[model samples]
Target: MSKERAQRRAEREREAAVLAAAKAAEAERHERREARRRAVASRLPKKRRGPSGVLADRRRTQTRLLVLAFLVLNVLVWLASGDWAVRILALVLTALVGPLVHILMTKN
Candidate 1:
């Protein structure tokens, strides 16, 4: 009876070891498959934006430059005249003119 019990315990240990080895092998295969996928993706070329995106980018840059120029002009107005009301009015107009022109130009 003692010999039979020893044999059964040994068999259970062997089965558990086999199961652990299978789990390890499956995880290694998954890692290798992921590596292969990343390598293939790296070899593909990146896609670029279309013409509409280019046009939108150009409009963005133009609007940014217009705002920068308006700020500079506002500073110049304040430096030259030094009046609170005049400076405030110039600043408001400077801020409004760019978007107004953009609206007018893009109106359909």
Candidate 2:
């Protein structure tokens, strides 16, 4: 009875050691992967993050506003006018506004 108890205790210790070793290996692997990811990220080009970034964000907002305005204008034109010529004219003008605004905004 005493010998059987001793054998069971030894078996449990062996299993615990095996589990601890597996956990240690997994932690090491995770650290290695994180290190590799950081190294790769460090090599990438940094994004613009100052006044230029602010200007870019502002420009994007302006562009979206322009698009929304043009969309609303086109919808109103189509809804208010029954003439095909007027609708086509509004579509053409809306298409031209995007490129013209882009050109004006990009001028330095």
Top candidate by TM-score: 2
lDDT (Cα, tens digit) per residue for candidate 2, span 1-108: 999999999999999999999999999999999999999999999776655587778877877887888899999999999999999999998797777977786566
Root-mean-square deviation of every model: 10.8, 5.7
C-alpha lDDT values of all predictions = 0.84, 0.89
TM-score (all chains, Cα) for each model: 0.45, 0.51
Kindly provide the TM-score of model 1 when superposed on the true structure, using C-alpha atoms. 0.45
Worst 10 residues of 2 by lDDT: 47-56
- The count of backbone overlaps in candidate 1 is 0
Instruction: Compose the digit string of candidate 1's lDDT tens values, residues 1-108.
Output: 999999999999999999999999999999999999999989998788755787777777776876777778888999998689999999788667867976765554
What residue pairs clash in candidate 1, if any at all? none
Q: Which parts of model 2 are misplaced by more than 4 Å? A: 13-52
Candidate 1: what lDDT? 0.84
